[model samples]
Target: MTPDEVIAAWDQPGATASIHPTRGISEGAYWASGEAQAALLAQDIPAGSRVMDFGCGDGRVAIPLRALGYDVTGVDASPNMLAALNRHAPDLATFRSDGSDFGKHLGRRKFDAVYCLAVLIHHSHETGQQLVERLRAVVRKGGILVLDWPVADEPAETNAWIGVTTWSRDQQDQITKRLGLTRLDVDRPWAVYQA
Candidate 1:
């Protein structure tokens, strides 16, 4: 599905629940390992650094990071999802934008670290590349970009609520190389890159 279609679907009633039936909220709200992510992030980023949660759905990562004392801003395409996040983290800054572009919503602001977790699978390879380029532009020099997506031996497509695409390790490597990003770590689907 197109990004617009995906956003429309997420805005529908119970859409968050549908994506995370057992958790009863979007995956971001109660995803396991929030502490682990926080710990990992703290190793490189100091407390109170500015962070951006790209494709932040329902404040799964942003809230925990905020509680850890980092200033966080979340950007998402679904108003319903952002509303859910607002209810949970009322003080957390948020903006409405499809994951493909951040400058359109967040102008000249740059982040110390930007994370796009479990959100890129829904985009096609072309769109994912575009998103990486846009995200790179918003990250400060020597900043971090953390991305998580399902890994496959070859590029593959799936039909869930919307069409989802997975990129292979080689594909991901090429993307990072093309963007002139240095790969810092790769724990399977989760890869950290430095700008």
Candidate 2:
């Protein structure tokens, strides 16, 4: 499936997922990680650097980044998620649109970092690859791309429980390499990348 096809399939109950408080899904923990991720990304981008929080769900990173004094624009496909963000991070810039299409929604604007965690797993390999490219365009060359997702031994086209799709580690690595990304690390519950 194409990138649009992959996300399009996830339009149903795909937005529903269990939140792990001890990990990224938890509000506090997620915020702390966002700070850490921001710090790592800050090493590459300046304080006023603009960040495109692609697939930003419930303002996990957007709220923190906005607090850290970074110009952030959070984008997500789920209206429910966007609503939560609208309530939590009202001051932050937000665009309700598909993560794979940030380039168009935001125009030719380029960001210093594209922080997308727990988002890419919703797409199949094809869509996931396209998303990587789209996000690359969303960021300026040499920009940071912080991301994380669930990894499985086998890739799948559909997850009925979540009403989404996903790619395996191998698939993800291959696409990242193809996109000329430099993988910083890949430990469970956390992954970092830069372009």
Candidate 3:
């Protein structure tokens, strides 16, 4: 699907319902390992630091980080998603923007850290490069950027809904290098880069 189509699908009624709280774990838990991962990421950053969760669907990561006392902002292409996020996290800030061009929506704002999880794989290679550049522009020097997406040795496969494009380690290495980012960690699908 095109980027607009993907956004429309996500904004449809009940599109985000499945991600809401379940019987045991809450929605945030179901999305980001029950907030454990978010806590880990927030551990090093001092309280009140600014963080942005790019493609921050329904506050999965943003809410938890906010709860940890960081100034968190959730950015996504879907207003419906941002609305849903507001319902759960009313005080958290949100902005509407596509993954490939969030810097424009943010104006001169920069973040101490950025989270772009489960987002990059939906874009083609060219679009992904644009997204990396935009994301880089928003992150402050010496800040961190966390990325997590499926990776495989096989060629990337695009679905009828949100297209999926997998990247190999080499591809990711080149991206970090081009962006002048230092790799801090590499655990399978997750890579932490310091700008």
Best by lDDT: 1
lDDT of 2 by residue, 170-191 (tens): 8778877888778775443456
Taking all chains together, the TM-score of candidate 1 against the true structure is 0.87
User: If candidate 1 were superposed on the true structure by all CA atoms, what would the RMSD be?
Assistant: 2.8
Residue 21 in candidate 1, Cα distance off native in Å: 6.3
Show model 2 residue runs off by greater than 4 Å. 1-46, 156-158, 161-169, 185-188
Measured by TM-score, the strongest candidate is 1
lDDT by residue for model 1 (67-96), tens: 889999999888898998999889899998
The superposed Cα distance between candidate 2 and the true structure at residue 165, in angstroms, equals 5.8
The clash numbers for all candidates, in the given order, read 1, 1, 0
TM-score of each: 0.87, 0.73, 0.85
Residue 176, candidate 2: Cα error in Å is 2.0
For all candidates in order, the CA lDDT equals: 0.77, 0.68, 0.76
Better of 1 and 3 by TM-score: 1
Better of 2 and 3 by lDDT: 3
